[model samples]
Target: MTVISVHVPKTGGSSFLDILRKNYGAKLLVDYGLEATTALAAMTSGEHEIVHGHFVADKYVDVQGARYITWLRDPIQRLFSHYQFWQRNKFPRSPFWRQQYYNNFTFEEFAFSPAVRNEQARYLGGMDIKTFSCIGITEFFVESMELFSKSLGMDIELDNLPQHRVNTLSKKGYELDDKGLRAALYEFHSLDYQLYIQGLEVFKSQYSQVSGCLDTRFWDLQKSSQKSFPPQFSLQKLLAEKQVSNVIGTYYYGDGWPINMWDTFRRDVVDEYLDEVRSDGFNTIILLFPMSLFKLKSSNQKAHEIFYNDLVFLLDKIRDKGLNFMFRLGYSWDGFPLSGDRGRVAFSVLCEGSSKDEFIEEARQLYLIAETYSEFLYGFITWEDLLMFPCNRAPKASEPMRIQLATELGFTGNSGAIPERDSGEFLGYLEFLDIKFTDLFMDLAVAFPRLSAEVRVDTTPYNDSDGGEHHYVHHRQFVETDCDVIGTYFATYMLPEKPTLNDMKRILSFVHRQLQVSDPSKKIFIDQLLLVIDESIGKGYSTISEKVIDAFVKWFPEWLDANSIGYATWAFCDYVWDVIFNGTFRYGPLGWEFGGNTMLVESAETRYVQMESGAWLRGGRILHFEPWPQRGCIQIELEVDDACSITVELSDSYTVELDKRDMSQVSSGKRQVITTEFEIVPEYLKILINGGAAKIYRVGLGKEISSCGGRDLNMNHRVTSRLIRELNNNYGGNC
Candidate 1:
């Protein structure tokens, strides 16, 4: 039988032809005729074992004893290699080169050219794909060749075959980094991309069955090949173990999406964004599932299937980028925010008259879906909407309604058995709601013990000093429940402008004290910390300065590690409409403000630096300083302008309760010096200037010895770090 190797350009055709020449010697037919038809005719008259040349498979369909064989490649990579090859071979002396070279084509132009667009599919156009005796991949050349040789009964020596890498870019340079150009190229050759993906699936199916025939030596060659070209099957790098300090992430808020359904199908857009996320040093992404999936009104299984498929696709992409996914299950879609039919069904479970079985089934389905992706799944955050107060007021449910809620939650004995909501036997109605809230979490905790089912609560009136209703009592009751992780939706910008610095300190202290008093061992997670800066809110900057970013990076981690394993920012990327700001009331980059606070720009550049121990914050309106990571003391020399006031506080342990005391304050036009002294080393320090202006001349961490006996007890060992270390020891660490 005569072997017909149809040469698809840039699919290792030339290299395979070289191998054929080596194997067959004089008997190999190497384009003996000037034209394809003439070549077939020449093959008929000769004693040739192989006929190799650039020709379509259809051209030789009628030829007797013709067996077609070819190789394929990843279309995007092939096109890139093709462009680079042409650019390298642009010789002015040759006529073909002179014409093309004078045109000075870009890689984009060459990629979009009609001559080579989807050229492989076009070359094999009319023939059934299975008709070819062996179709191989250029990426996995060794494996493909082994399969090709075995199928065709050819003597291809794996050890001796020359693997020539022609016109290849380095691993990093291989990808099309330009988002716009990459997008244009993908759109232009969308058909080829689909074919390539299909081909990969086919190749994988064939590869597994052919394993019985694969020589032991073939894997040895594969291992060697991987040293340079890397195996095609493994695209993503193995994820590294996350550091205690750098495990920071963001809530990919589905509600903030411009449309209810995002075109996550766009490979170029998603790839670019994921790369940006990886570059930002985040190891986790919390994908908030849209509430449309849970809506009782629409049981569109097709829509569910489509979304699940999309989620799996996005998860694969996320994993390939070496990031873990935390599923935030069942939040309402922004287009139809969980009201009416949807809201009623969800709330009925939490309210008095509802089916406990329906609620359990809902939780069960979410748990099952989560289990399917346990490989990449890190944890889960339960629906946050359950904590909403009607009309933004406390305890809309009356005492009778609260009793009904407790009954629904299966609370035994008397509601009076629980502590009163307030000291005076007044407002005991609110305490009943907390009891129900605890029951809901306890139910989920028992059902999904495998994952750390974190409950994210709203920390409204962040500080008790506001004289408004404080939710700390509710928070204390919730943390005391069986929740695996404690989390809250808090933003520093929510504090009053005058007491911004002091209020932040108080909020953190209250949280720490609650954690210590309840169960210090429980892990905490800041589900959302807004990173925005608005001039209208006295933020006074269009974009954040390195100083502001530095202070946040330096202090936020210390604050988090004191109580929790990690924290996440409010958002990663979002789409905005009309004006950037909705009103004169400018706000920070939290999800609630400016419509969107995308951490990454379209180009994948970050608005802030990745913070760590060695991170620096210098040269801005705020002075540079080293933070007392262990010893929370701070000393500052300030130059206050006329009518300006400055506020400063140290964040240490709960025992200090610095918020209850006021020591340092600076007034206008005077030089003032202040030093903080607490019972223990503080983990964070805050400074805010109000009125005209103020300049921090110098600031630095305190070197004074700790009086609390040792480093703050809260941070002696990180819960996340220990957990990861144990996981790594159990399962081979990386990836």
Candidate 2:
């Protein structure tokens, strides 16, 4: 049996390779020459099978009655993912998607013209056309996967499957209109739209019966998996229980991605990694990765690598810089462990299958890889996209997968296997040791509690509250799924004309109430999140409306109330552009969620910190401050130029109907002094340190604009993964 596995970026290739060893053992070819095309020839020489890796076209030719299968995504999303690959590796440079909104308030540029995405598909042999028996639309993956498995007469358990490995920030997210339609039409063209429609057909076929027809177990496991052993008590309870925090104000999905960075560069001008933490509100940052940043890299490949490496170094350096940080861990293709990646290990699945590490040396190899940078490496991870839990084809079971993993550790005795990571049973295993791979991460978290580390790796159950894929389940399962489905319904329907900060807040507010009683792990996650905002929200920036601020703060109000979170809205930078162009982040009353960092609010409720943020007006200008959370606050001073007028408000308008109290303002020479204060609503109100409105002023005289926040959040701009990693490295976090 020739077991071939194609190593795509986010596919489940790793887990499949593990399966090959169980069924093929030594017969599996592990030599590079035996991979891909050479497999057919190699198989003739012996009673053997070839596990595949990175086999694009030629490998599957002329195999009599052989099953040919693969997965695909909407062309637009694929391009974005592919684009990110280059950006992370440094091929093309662009601002992150979100940052563009901050500066331009438009996602039109980053969007795929239907023509481009479809054109790529047409070139890729219509793979995007659902030409295979097991065509999988990643969005409805659970069902597609199950159907594929069944077609091959394989039984996969759904109880423990991982979900949403490949993530794409929707170009058409939120609501839309004629302007939106025309823009998409112009940008995407007919070909891309056709691919999308074809893909939609596949999505509807298998997923209509259930939300995603994924193993319903995902919902259950998502909730049941992590139990902190003996039920952790409190911050007081956790006096004994240990924790972890993974921050990702800046995570690199792939290439010129985050296109927001270019603008962030122009806006924030990120110079160092810690500088990024400063850019994101300091304290600590949890940077995430998948097997995401692979060979091709991004447009700024060298620069991105430098940034990534700088961050690795900065993880430790942050401790020196007097800031906090975290290290996030995740796999490239799905939540699968990259260390066990067969493609990287042996270059192909066949080679990997034939060369099973009798002792699974990969874990040790992983530790070594992680150990290179002793400075930051705060903790392990569950990629942010992992939140999109449960698809129609959610894994059938982890038992088969677990059994394979057990063998990796050389489980000689039938009692040696442990529970599978996702689902299914390692029936032979009875030994439950504390030193499993889980321990590797747990040890790191405990050793660095200051970083408040934790993993949101598993798609805990089908929660109605989460975002992305898991959230999709609620609608698909309840409303209707058909062959014609092609929308993501992001609660945008309830939005108003000209959304305001209050409107954004109301929306996020609904998200808040819906998620009020998060699982213990999520609560812990939020705390560390707040701690992050408290320490560093000062120097970095955001450029959304007061409504954007309201939306952001409302989602994690607890952190705000706890004085552990803050934000910078990049308003100062936007103001400069606004002055130059007569524009503002204010949209609809407050709907200004652009791409990338434009909505820079991740893990806000995932960790703890003591932070405060408020906007002040003096000399007729507005000045807002949001601190990172999980830590306490301190007073600060600044200097300003003469001839500027400013007015400071304690809060943004769309949310938090303030009792409207009056307070006194304080001042200094050119710079004024403001202290973060707690409000009756609990969160610290904005301090009035407004330097007043004035023309652009220069600080740190020679710092590069690219080294600071961009002049504005450019839609195509992105705060590089390099910068993000740098922050983690300095603050003491991930790789």
Each model's Cα RMSD: 27.1, 26.3
Q: Rate the local accuracy (lDDT) of all candidates.
A: 0.48, 0.32
Largest TM-score belongs to which candidate?
Answer: 1
User: Per-residue lDDT tens digits of candidate 1, residues 403-469?
Assistant: 5543443333244222223423222333434544444544454455444434433344332323356
User: Could you tell me the TM-score of candidate 2?
Assistant: 0.28
* lDDT tens digits by residue: candidate 2, 77-195: 45555545444453223345334434542334445323234443443353434444445555444565566555554555545444443222222423333555544543454554444
Off by over 4 Å in 2: 1-228, 231-281, 293-311, 331-497, 516-559, 562-735
